[model samples]
Target: MEMFRGFLFISIAMILFSLNLSNVEGRIHYHKKQKKGSPVEPPTYAPSPDDPVSQSPSYPPPVSQSPSYPPPVSQSPNDPPAVPSNPSDPGNTTSEDCVFDVMAFGAVGDGCTDDSAAFAAAWKEACAVESGVVWAPSNLTFLITSTIFSGPCKPGLVFQVDGVLMPPNGPDNWPKTDSKKQWLVFYRLDDMTLTGSGTIEGNGDQWWELPCKPHRGPNGSTKPGPCDSPAMIRFFMSSNLVVSGLRIQNSPMFHMKFDGCEGVLIEKLSISSPKLSPNTDGIHIENTKSVGIYDSVIANGDDCISIGPGCSNVNIEGVTCGPSHGISIGSLGVHNSQACVSNVTVRNAIIKNSDNGVRIKTWQGGAGSVTGISFENVQMDNVRNCVIIDQYYCSTKACQNETSGVYVTDVSYKNIKGTYDVRNPPIHFACSDTVPCTNITMSEVELLPEEGELVDDPFCWNAYGIQETVTIPPIDCLQDGGPEAIGESGTYGCY
Candidate 1:
């Protein structure tokens, strides 16, 4: 009876796989606990039209038997987004006229001291002065508690972080009066440069063990609690900002979050966190515009860079990401919300030993459109899902599929060469049945297996696109013939 049940489960899974009805989890964990066998070799060309495997453009069959149930959904560490610190000192060599040092405003550089007040005082002083410098002296570890640096500050203010700034020890150490949503926030600031080769540490060891974290519960279930963890640094509703030349690490949640901000430039930085740290996204940008992220190294638990809802005109280049979930355009349109994102590009990047390469994910029951995005000149090494577009992204297995879906179209992948982990498919584009992805183009994509095994085939469902050049591990799965509504564009601009 047990053997019969197992056989029945395998038959059901095989039917689902053949019909392209399986979810993203089913596709990713297709190799879970399988019996050892000879690796399936990648096909050099598309299957013949009459071939049984040629019925769909979705991925070809694996050698292993399909599992009974889908794997658990990988939830983002960030949830229940309600919305969207400190200081200081002067032992500086730069003798600027508008220098407002925190130490001058009664800031103790001691690592144990709560210097939030002093940092706030210095910012207040400098916000009024043009081209002012809020200096945190070198060789100091200034401990700061929760603080919000509200701004519409004077143009061209520089917050030179030459030392270390750390938050409170843990949740137990947090002050009841302060909100745990975000630790240090630059709110509504303009023409500011937050730069310098300094370190901003979240001291997030305790936060990772929280009940709400992904690995804390049985089968990745969540335990009940306040479950709120603070983001390390957030720029909210700020414009003309530059965050560069810093080392940020170990965030309770997202290391850097930009929400409702515009005209931002992030460059020349190193961001990191433990691979086990929950939700420690290197940099997260949302509801922001005209942002450029360049020349950065990010090794973190979550996405190296995440482009969230209502974001446009984002450009990322010269980034090295590893030991992380690679750059993601989203798990957007969550909870049936509308997500509008466009004009994003990620190029000249390297992603190694990451869970994903370049991914664009959206939930099932949502509205809005994602268009005019391109991923070019990206190199991957041992990446699990080298390139993917998963429209039915549910964080829980219990989520029911909905007809309403976000529109994803006009995406191009160019010069994406890499070696992928033998586990997951090299490319997976599982678009919604309702709103099919259109005008997807790929060129010069060569993904081989990192280990000495055969490469996996690309997977596609309702993904209509044109391949400009022949791709490695041939994307025979990508469907041809896009809709007439696409190919030509007005609002999203001609790709």
Candidate 2:
């Protein structure tokens, strides 16, 4: 009976041990299945030393993903780690490229310091990189001297100017070693863009007081000394350029000038100066082609926009001009030189309190042609000489009436509704005696006196065209058929 009891106890112990081993095996198998099927947390990556964000020690920490988000795709041990979209993430790899910050290159953004060297250095770095951005960060002001940002850079470079740019305070501080004709010049660039919510302050009050400036001398005449004033900004020999969203003000001379550029676009600019500022044209383009200037406001002493010699295929629309000389073509063909301008269209413009609206002036002793010009949908308010073509345009009274002149032909005006100042004729066409204007057409042109009754009539001299619709004050002076040559001197070749 004792042996039987001992055997029974041994059997019970064996059964219990067997049940415990089975439970352990099941738990192990369940854990293996979970390891094969469940998503695994991705490993953290360290940023490489060559990373742009890592190069700048002052950059903020990298931003991290939310805890509730799913894990990232698993990376192989041999593959490169993924870069973080947000560089401030502490747990992710951070990287940035091709953003050349001017402040990072030792620019002191105090409004008084000279930051031109720093800007040039930053531009050099940016120009070498493809599609790089040269950033002038916000909430800062940089004082620069006469600078030339020259480039034959890689495609798609951008000058991002979010901060204020100011020149030296007037003419006294202008650098003698630098050029006196340009404050900021861009040269030889292609496929570039200059844009920002920045202000380019010329600080031109003292420069305007120079004796050589117009009306600054005795008896409202210019003095005969050396008179050289710098334009605020100039683009030279560039192509496929864009300039927009800038506020340029108080220039000593022209606010903006473009020379020898093609495929240029300028829009949404605000340009202003005192009405008495001499030679302060808002925009001036010479030898440019395929240009568009739209949606801009300009108030200055000279022409709001001036089309100089060798310009073609220009379109100016949605522009507002006030206290200015209005839009002008020429003062071209000067000094017996040849000039050519064609295919210019100005539409949807407003000219208010200006000296002239839509004028074409050429010198007497010169040759070339101005053709295929159209001015449509223009509204004038208290403007003088609303529409004019003066072949005898001379700044001084000593201009001699030479036999040769720039031929004006194929010009049309439509929907030109306006009020004139009444001191001058609303439409004055004083073409050259030898070379008369031809094919001048007008339609829907209605002009009335701003103050009193219409005292002056529309004047024309040797101008020829057909009036599609009757003008306000009858222009009986215009000849009916094509222009008749006065003599053999009327024929000249335009180069």
| Model 1 per-residue lDDT at 454 | 81
- Which regions in candidate 2 have their CA more than 4 angstroms from the true location? 1-96, 486-495
Question: CA RMSD for every model?
Answer: 28.3, 15.2
Best by TM-score: 2
- Residue 180 Cα positional deviation in candidate 1, in Å, after optimal superposition: 0.8
Model 2 weakest lDDT span, ten residues long = 83-92
**Per-prediction TM-score to the true structure, in the order listed:** 0.79, 0.80
Question: Local error of candidate 2 at 228, Å?
Answer: 0.6
> Whose lDDT is greatest here?
2
lDDT of 2 at 193: 72
CA deviation > 4 Å runs, candidate 1: 1-95, 483-495
